[model samples]
Target: MRIVVLAGGIGGARFLRGLKQAAPDAEITVVGNTGDDIHLFGLKVCPDLDTVMYTLGGGIDEEKGWGRTGETWSVKEELAAYGVGPDWFGLGDRDFATHIVRTQMLAAGYPLSAVTEALCARWRPGVRLIPMSDDRVETHVLIDSPDGSGRKAVHFQEYWVRHRASMPAHAVLPVGADRAAPAPGVLEAIGAADVVLFPPSNPVVSIGTILAVPGIREAIADAAVPVVGLSPVVGGAPVRGMADKVLAAVGVESTAAAVARHYGSGLLDGWLVDTADAASAAEVEEAGIRCRAVPLMMTDTDATARMAQEALDLAEEVRA
Candidate 1:
């Protein structure tokens, strides 16, 4: 099968691993979200891309879910001693090597898509991972502080890592999205896909960011295959990450049915909700998309693979 998956960071990476286990022979192409990319210490840091690559490439810190395995904090400590901060986002020494290479390639006039391919050359992440867009598209969060002043826009990472999503967000903006074109292979992958799966990733920032790129959503809508989505909301809350906070920013409800409707039947052909939300299946189906209730928890590889199978099964059902 030619499967195209829209991915975010840690959760997307884990789901991809399970998808591989579920269908080892299938061809998978991942369109990774690049809205979290930031320039730090003169190096280009693509957090979401690196997270997926390292997690699948077997160099990831499984416990932390981000950064490299067997990581050391000497570089972080030294930087801190020099009063060079933004210490909230931990960039390990080993992970720094990746940013260095990526930055060098980008500076040498290689597009981000090409630089990502060059980086993946060493990691061999198994699937072809492409950025959502070659053009810069950064996700920013608009939030009001404790003083109740006007809303101010902050980088997604700053809202996520530094503030921990504690503040109420007024809006979520994908800066530069209006002009950002999908990366070279992104639309083609979706256009030629046998199945398009939306992993149980943060809908607003992860999958939503990918869709923000021009032509990506249109490609999926125009694809001849089924487009299926797994709810990140298992039981009224996200499996991981503060997805609810961001979802609220866009006036979307946090329920499984509401999230499915947020993506809408126009874009999605099938929706997978947790067994706990079986009651909501009918509502989703009523929205013009086929819905299935299954165990959507990623407890381990086996459980995640089961979820992947369920999604594929639903895709087949919708196609039939």
Candidate 2:
């Protein structure tokens, strides 16, 4: 089987791990969200792409869910000691090397997709991983300052990593999505896939940002395979991350049914919610999506593989 997965950081990476185990023979292609990419300290950082690569390649810090396991912060600390700080955004010494190499490759006229492939050569992250777009598409959140500093937009990282999404987000926009084209193989993977999946990543910023890239949503909708998704929200809350905040910004409630409706039936053929949210299945199905409720937690690799298997099962059901 050929599977194309639209992914973000941590959650997406973990899901891919289980998908690999669940369907050991399947060919997997990951289209990672680059909207989370940022330029910091004169280096380019592709957080989501790196996360997926590291996690799949056995270089990831399993407990923390991001970054290298045996990481040092000498670079970050040196920068802070010089009072050159955005200390709130943690960048470790080991992780910094990735940004440096990516920035250097980009400066040498390589597109991000090519740079990603080159970097993956070292990590050898089992699947074919590609960026959603070769162009920049940073996600920014519109929020009002709590201390009467008035309304302003901040990078999505600031809203999430810095403030922890505590402030109300009035809007979330992808800064360069207007003219962004799908990275070379993204549309081709979806079109040639037996199944497409939306992992339990942050729906609004992760999956939504990928879809915002021109031609991606259209490609998924027109693909001849089953396109399925697992709910990030389980029992009225996100399994991880502050997805509810961005979902609110987009005017969607953070529930299994609401998330399924947000994606809508046009692009999604199957939707999986946690067993705790089983009551929502009918409402989701009523909205024209085939809904199934199952154990959705990823407490371990076994648990996550079960979730992936369920999604594939749902895809087969949709295909029938």
Candidate 3:
């Protein structure tokens, strides 16, 4: 089977690991969200892409579900001692090497897609991971400035990593997605896929931002395969992160049914919600999406794989 997955950060990375276990023989292509990419200290950082790669390659910090395993913080400590910092965003010594190599390759004029491929050669993440767009598409959040000043736009990293999404966001926009084209294999993978899935990643800034790219959303909608999604919101709250804050920014309620509707029946053929949200299944189906209530938590690889299997089963049902 050929499957395409649109993924972002920790939730997405962990889901991909489960998907791999569920379909070991399947050819998986992950279209990673580059909207989370940021340049820090003159080095480019692709957080979502690295998370997926690291998780799949068995290099992920199991406890944190992101970053390198057994990571050290010497470089971060040294930078702090210099008193030059946005110390809130933690990038450890081991993680710095990734940024350094990525920045160096980018400076040599290799597009991000090529650089990612080179890096993955070492990790052998098992799936073909492609950025949503090779062009920069930094997500920014509009929020009130500190000291009760007027509203201002901040990088998504600042709003997410620094403030921890504490402030009310007026809007979330992907700065350069308007002109960005899909990375080399993104469209092709979607076109050739047997199934496509949106994992339980943050809807607004993760999957939503990847869909913001010019052609990706259209490609998935028009593809012959069944496009399914697992709701990130269970009952009335996110499984992880501050997805509710960002979801509110887009005027979507933090509920399984609401999120399924947010994606819409036109794009999504099937939707999965947690058993905790079984009551919302009918509402999702009424909106023209095939809905099922299943266990959606990623408590462990085994549990997560069951969720993946449920998603694939729903896709096949839709296809039938």
Clashes of each: 0, 0, 0
TM-score for predicted model 1 compared with the true structure: 0.98
Displacement of the residue 160 alpha carbon in candidate 2, Å: 0.4
lDDT of 2 by residue, 101-216 (tens): 99999999999999999999999988999999999999999999777888899999999999999989999999999899999999999989999999999989999999999899
Write down the TM-score of every candidate: 0.98, 0.99, 0.99
For model 1, residues 1-320, the per-residue Cα lDDT tens digits are 99999999999999999999999999999999999888888888999999999988999999989999988889889999999988998999999999989899899999999999999999999999999998998899999866768778999999999999998888999999889999999988888899999999999999999998888999999888999999999779998999999999999989999999999988999999999999999999999989999998888889999999999999999899
Select the stronger candidate by lDDT from 1 and 2: 2
RMSD to the hidden true structure, all candidates: 0.9, 0.8, 0.7
Candidate 1 ranges with C-alpha deviation above 4 Å = none
Residue pairs with backbone overlap in model 3: none
Candidate 2 global Cα RMSD: 0.8
The residue ranges of model 2 lying beyond 4 angstroms of the native Cα positions read: 147-149
TM-score computed on alpha carbons, candidate 3: 0.99
Q: Write model 3 residue lDDT over 38-120, tens digit each, in one string.
A: 88888899999999989998889999877899999998888889987878877877788989999999999999999999999
- What residue pairs clash in candidate 1, if any at all? none
